[model samples]
Target chain A: MAFASALKCRECGREYPTDPLNVCEFCFGPLEVAYDYEAISRAISRERIQNGPLTMWRYQDLLPVDGDHAVDLQTGFTPLMKAPNLGRLLGLDHLYIKNDAVNPTNSFKDRVVSVASTKALEYEFKTLACASTGNLAGSVAAHAARAGMNAYIFIPADLERGKVVGAAIYGPTLVAINGSYDDVNRLCSELADTYPWAFVNINMRPYYAEGSKTLGYEVAEQLGWQAPAHCIVPSASGSMFTKIWKGLKEFEDLELIPKVHTHMHMTQAAGCAPIAEAYEAGVTRVRPVKPNSIAKSLAIGNPADGYYSLKTIQESDGDATIVPEDEVVAGIQMLAENEGIFTETAGGVVISGLKRLVERGAIKRDEVTVAYITGNGLKTLEAVEDTVRSVTIDPTTSSFEEQVLNA
Target chain B: MGVTVRIPAPLRRVTNDQDRVEVDAENLADMVDAMEEQFPGIKERLIDETGSLRHFVNIYVNGEDVQFLQGLETAIKASDEVSIVPAVAGG
Candidate 1:
């Protein structure tokens, strides 16, 4: 049985039944899935989770879905390895990388889409739709294909070619709008009212967002049932950043962990860093900006959870950093060269923001820090296409040595 | 044809369950005023105390956001279709 009890409004503290509703009718605030923790505490344990499935469904007790026949694709339980090479270079001792890029769809969006798709089926919805920047489009389409549902994926027209092809490969009805991600989201909101399809990120968001807590669950469990000292995550809509922290705290509340003092740091590209800018200005109001960044995946200017993310950062005593557009490529190169992990622009923002935080003394040298790498580099080849250098030589030993080796 | 304003589901209660209302107004500001005059308490929800559009409320004129146009002063023709949509939480 699912432990989720109600969908509660984040702002007005209003509660409603666990339906496919994201926004509160009265306050217009986001509705979050509120679980029956007392029952979950009795049902879940370390031994139970360890004995569960190897995928994200292992934390099914904490998630909002009933995991009878989930829309699984071997999504989560990604590697959490110590990054000594990256750590030593960044002047740190205890540094690890939560490599979520190795997921089925090559991004962390799979986790949420997996849960959302399962919930959509439970609600008897035939169509799965979403307004994606890039990664989510691919994830939602893949899940819809697995569930045998019709998929309608919408995105900004100028998205990455790899991401567009990635979603299209699943045979979803991909619509590319000639505007920004925010514009596409607004249009989808209107469409959600007219259609009976389940928009994963819109109508099904209350349950969709609960899937991110598995990241936190895995991190703590992989670390021998203890929360790390610091967690640096990439922020777009700020949902994942806040949910990761929420996962850690939920474990603490359930007596699964002693206590979580993890500092949640958020990173963003300078071109579209509204949450980071709000945190920097010591305010709760996030002023939206026109996105102009190479990190198109993290280019949501008007973030929905910007206010709550700021509140999470302040509550956790965490910091937010913005990476310059030029340094984004450098950050990607840094991780690739140092740790042999080729990550996309969002990961680059995390690594670059990590450097800034370390340089500014916000993160101590010996603290346990886990840097989240959310996407694979293959999807964003254009961001680092200029860094490629190839030599043209004939099939001769002498020509190879002279052109490639000597040069 | 007149300026037809489409009310979102949340604000339909104030409009007496009327999904669409025909209002005679020149611009967005006058439209909000007319809506308040008809609905009695909707202006406070659409516009904040500072007299600016609330952050969570979006006003679209013929599928174009008013923020992209002249905002409150955006001229409205008689045949325009206005929609008041609530901002969605991100994906």
Candidate 2:
């Protein structure tokens, strides 16, 4: 049973009916899914959650949607593996990789789209729409197809070819806007008001953003109810970073865990890291910049939740860092070589950010750290296209001996 | 001084479908007031009831964000080009 009472304004104290609304009409502040923790504390239990499906819905009471209209494609409940290889390399005792790269859409976006699509159905929206950098477009299209809803997915024109085909395969009306991710998002914000569609990250955002909490829940549960010492998450819109923090706090509030003192670390690619730039500059405001990065998935220049993300990072006493382009490539290669887990560019950012944090002594060597791997490498083969090409040899033993054994 | 504000498509309804409008105001807060006088519902869209500029709406003067300047109190000048760009988020 959903314990969600209403959608409450994040900036203002006003509450509104749970509807297909993103920002508050009165204050224009983002609306969030407000839940009754006291009621949830009583209604939910560990056994109850364990008995549910092996998907994100396992934490059903915590989610805002009803079970009846849940649009699911087996999203979430991904593996939380103890990365002994990566840990040893980083000189950390405990290192975990939240391998969400294996999701249905091969990205963490499936988690959010599942909830948003279901909530759209609940609200009787006929279409599922959104402006994406890449990952979200594919996820939205797939979810829309599953729900038999008309889908209109928009993206920046220069997105990865794989992501373009990924969404196109789902038969959504895909439109490529000739601008940055920020431009696409701006157009979607306007389109969301004009069209009667459920733009997952716009009109249906409150429900969509809540889906990220499952990542936190899964980590805690996988860790046997112990929160990690540090969680390094990549920031785009910065929603997931803050949501993970909220998730841990909620788990403790619901008595699922005794306590959580997790330091929320944020990762960003240097090319488009407005939040990190602000943090480094020691300013409370985020200044937007035009993005020029290979990590296209995490390139939301004017992040909607930048201010709040800054606050969450500061309040959690967390540290954030941005990885250079070369380090991003190395991070992906390091993970693939060390743990056999191939990840997208955004995952590389997380790994590299963790590396920088460790080197700078911001993230300690002894602390238990979980770096969120947000997407699969296959979705962004272009990023590693030139880096890891196989050596060509003649089909003969002599050729192999000369190219490999002799070398 | 008179300045031209390029309103985004979302807020054009309040401006009677005019994409750009020239308003005489000394500062951003005064510009908001002047725009509200011309378009009654524009202030509610741009600012919260508490009167602070909405976080999602970014106001820029001559290509520089007002936030880096003096925010709503940033002074204006004649021929200054003001643009109201909404924050782009997702992905």
Candidate 3:
């Protein structure tokens, strides 16, 4: 049975029956799935969760779906690695890495797309659609293919070729908008109004967003059912930051863990850091900016969830910071060199922001901190190409050793 | 709080997809409340029931986020501009 109670407007407190709707008709507010938490609390147990699938569906009881229609891409259950070497390099004692680069799409978006596609199937929609930056497009296409649905994905025109190809490989209808992600999103919003397709982040947003909670759930579980003292997450729209906090709170509410004291830190690229700007200015509302960061994955000029990120960070006693482009590149190199992790530009922003926070004495070095790496470096190679050195040598042992190894 | 507010595509349904709207308010809170009254349920998508803004919705007054001003209580003037932006993740 689906544990979902109803769809409730986040602003007006008005509730509606569960359906494929994302916005409220009366108030124009975004709709979220309300659940019978009492029932979920009673049914979901640690033993039960352990026995379930290793993927995100393991917590199906807490999810929105009701049948075998969950679009599964084997997402979630990723590694929460102890970054001993990386931490030591940064002068920290305890640090962890929620490495989502290993996800099927090489990003954390797979987690949300899985849930979105599953809900689309449950809604009996034959076509899947979304307006993505890059990661979500690939994830939606991949999951739509897995679910045997026709996919129509939209993205910005200038996205990385790798991501474009990745989405196209899934045999989806890929459309490139000439403007920024905001323009693509605007077009998708119009399409959502006229078309019956399931735009995951549009009409299926309530469920689509729930997938991110799995990231938080996995981190706590991997940490042996304990919330970290602090979590530094790269924020674009700010959804991931809030969802992680929600996931931890849900665990605490379920008695799966003790009271959650995890302070959430929001990181951003300085070129497009409206949220961080607001945070530093001691504000709650974020003004949109024109994004100009190499970390395009996290370059939402107008973050939908920017306010919440600031609130979460401030309420948790955590802070938000934006890293300059040079620092972002340095951060990417630092992670690659110290932890053997090739993170994308967003990760660079995160790592650099963590360093800034540490330097400002905002984050205690001794605290058990978890830095989330959301995407793989291969997706954003252009950002670090300048710093990544390559040695050209003939196919000879001596030449290879002299040019590459000895260099 | 009397300023013109711009709404993005994702939130157009709440605001008739109209690119912008004029509302009367003194701060982000009043603007949101005013927008909610004019658009109904819109404030919820932008703010939670407890009056706190949602995580994915960003509200800026005159290209300045209220988070740095007075948060919800940031005072606004008729000459200011407000824009509601959601985090667009698809690239």
Candidate 4:
């Protein structure tokens, strides 16, 4: 049974039927999935969730989709591992890393696409589409292939080679537009009006975004039904960061967890830090910028949820940090070297921002902090290409000893 | 050969359900004023009370976001295609 009640406008209190609509007709505000929490509270139980599949679908009661036609990729339910090594280095006592990099597509996009594709199939849509930075393209293609739907993925032309090849391997009609992600998004928005395809992030976004709340659900459940004090998340469009907080709050309201006191810190690359810039300037409006960051996945200049994310941070008493372009690779190296978790540039932005937060005394040393590692490092190898070093030796143990151990 | 203004679905009610409307104007600011003259209550939706474009709405001139160009002062010529779209988020 789907607990979602209606598609409500975030700005205006207008509600629409559960359809493939993203913007409110009256206010042009983004439409969000409003659920019948009373029903969810009655239906959901810790034991019921535990007995379900070891995936994001476990929280199906809170999600917007019915379980009848789910396009299951076995996504989500990622490991919430204790990051003792990195925590010690950062001067935090209890630190955890919600490693979403281990998802089906090696990124958290699988979670959203899983829900969106399932809804698309339920709506009887023949095609799946999105305007992706990198990760979402591959995810949409994979999910479309799984559900036997035609896929049309649009992306910026300058995206990473791994991401480009990743989507292409899934046999989707991947269109690399010669413009930024924002430009590609605008084109897709226009296309969504003309085409009948279910653009996951454009037309089918209300249901698609609900998938992110599962991340928050999984974290609290994994941590014994307790919300972390601080959650540092890398923000591109600020959707996931906001949704994660919403997830925690929903759990708290449902009496599934204690009152959520999670300080939702948002991290962004310095090259494209509109939300951080707004926070630093003490302004409510987010000014867009042309993205110039290696953390390309989090490079949405005109973030749709920028205002909502800023509001979430202020309400949570959390802070936003901007990581310099130079430190992104260093952040990636630190996590990989210490915790053996190879995360993409977005994760680097989170780690680097977390370090800055710690150094400035913003984050308490004893606070139970969780930094989200959203994507796999393998997809963005170019960001750390120079860091790849090898010991050149004649294939012999004597050469290894002489060149490495002796030297 | 006036500029072609492509109206999105949300604003089509104000445009008499017409998807595309043609108007004559020199710049985006004038174009908006012209649109207001043709279709009342649109300028308020596109622009906030502070006289800036609403954060939820984006105006693109010939496939380029007007914010990147000259914002409200962006120049528009004959046969130019202007699109008004609601901002949608995801990555």
Q: Highest TM-score among the candidates is held by which one?
A: 4
Q: How accurate is chain B of model 2, given as a TM-score from 0 to 1?
A: 0.94
Chain A TM-scores, candidates in order = 0.99, 0.98, 0.96, 0.98
Error of 4 at B35 (Å): 2.1
Model 2: pairs clashing at backbone N, Cα or C within 3 Å: none
lDDT of 3 by residue, A1-407 (tens): 36999989775778988887776554455677899999899899899999988888887887788535677778889888889988987778988999999999899998888888888888889999998888998999999899999999988888887788988999999999878776677567657766889999888888888889988898988889999998999988888898899899999999999999998888988888988999988878677777788888887777766766777887788888878877988989999999999998899988988888888887677888999999999988777777766777798999988888887
Quote the RMSD, in angstroms, for model 4.
Answer: 1.4
Give one digit per residue, the lDDT tens place, for model 3 in B30-49: 88888888888776667666
Q: How is the predicted docking of candidate 2 categorized under the CAPRI scheme?
A: acceptable
- List ranges where model 3 is wrong by over 4 Å: A397-407, B1-91
Per-residue lDDT value at A186 in model 4: 91
Error of 1 at A215 (Å): 1.5
Q: Please rank every candidate by TM-score, starting with the best.
A: 4, 1, 2, 3
Q: Estimate each model's TM-score.
A: 0.95, 0.90, 0.84, 0.97
Residue A128 lDDT in candidate 1: 100
lDDT of 2 by residue, B1-91 (tens): 4799987655776788897899999999999999999999889889866777777787878766677689899999888989886664477
Please write out the lDDT profile of model 4 over residues A1-407, one tens digit for every residue: 36888989988789999988888877688999888888888888899999999999889898889865689989999999999999999999999999999998899999999999999998999999999999999999999999999999999999999999989999999999999999999999889988999999988898899899999999999999999999999999999999999999999999999899899999999999999999999998888899999999999999989999999999899989999999999999999999999999999999999999999998888888999999999999898988898778899999999999998
lDDT of model 2 at residue A13?
A: 65
**Candidate 3 docking band:** incorrect
Off by over 4 Å in 4: none
Write down the worst ten-residue block by lDDT for model 3 chain A.
A21-30
lDDT of each: 0.91, 0.87, 0.82, 0.92
DockQ score for model 4, please?
0.73
lDDT sort, best first: 4, 1, 2, 3
